[model samples]
Each structure stands twice: as C-alpha cells, then as structure tokens.
Target: SDQRTAWLPAFLAYYNARRPHSALGYQPPASRIPGNNLLQLNS
Candidate 1:
C-alpha cells in the first residue's frame, strides 16, 4: 500500500500530462492548458 501510494501520484501526473485521450482528439490534457510550455516542446 505504501508503494502504491508513492506511485499513484506519479501515474496520475503522467495520465493527465502525457497520456492522450480519444475525447480530446488524442492530445494530453495538459496540452489544453494555456501557457503550458511542455506542449510547445512536444510539438
């Protein structure tokens, strides 16, 4: 459980920041946020 707790936040971060969603036209959720420099770097 401690290990799961430690990794859960990391997994959620990746899910919202890097994983593409079909409903979002295959773009990560972070890409939709304004001024997200990571999006520009990825593109």
Candidate 2:
C-alpha cells in the first residue's frame, strides 16, 4: 500500500533506534548497534 510505503521508513527508524529485539539478546536497537553508524546518523 502507498500509505504503508510512506510510513515504512519512519517505522524502521524507530525500530532500529529504540525497539528491543529478542534475536539480539533482548537488547534495544541501540544496544545491539555495532559502532558509530547510529552516532553518525544523529550528526
């Protein structure tokens, strides 16, 4: 759906920023982050 497509990035941003994942050992996306990639995003 077009509406869902538009909202996808936003959803991913939050998912990769704040959402915790059981696959990553019950850690928030931030904790599971590997390095400075996320840091670079904010800059």
User: In candidate 1, what residue range of length 10 has the lowest lDDT sum?
Assistant: 33-42
TM-score versus the correct structure, for each prediction: 0.68, 0.51
Candidate 2 regions exceeding 4 Å error are 34-43
Tens digits of lDDT, candidate 2, 5-35: 9999999988887787899886777775557
Q: What lDDT does each candidate get?
A: 0.88, 0.79
Give the lowest summed-lDDT range of ten residues in model 2: 32-41
1-43 in candidate 1: lDDT tens per residue? 9999999999999999999999999999887877646566568
State how far residue 10 of model 1 sits from its true place (Å). 1.3
Root-mean-square deviation of Cα positions for candidate 2 versus the true structure, in angstroms: 4.9
Total clashing pairs for each candidate = 0, 0
Name the regions of candidate 1 deviating beyond 4 angstroms. 36-43
Positional deviation of residue 34's Cα in model 2 after best superposition, in angstroms: 4.7
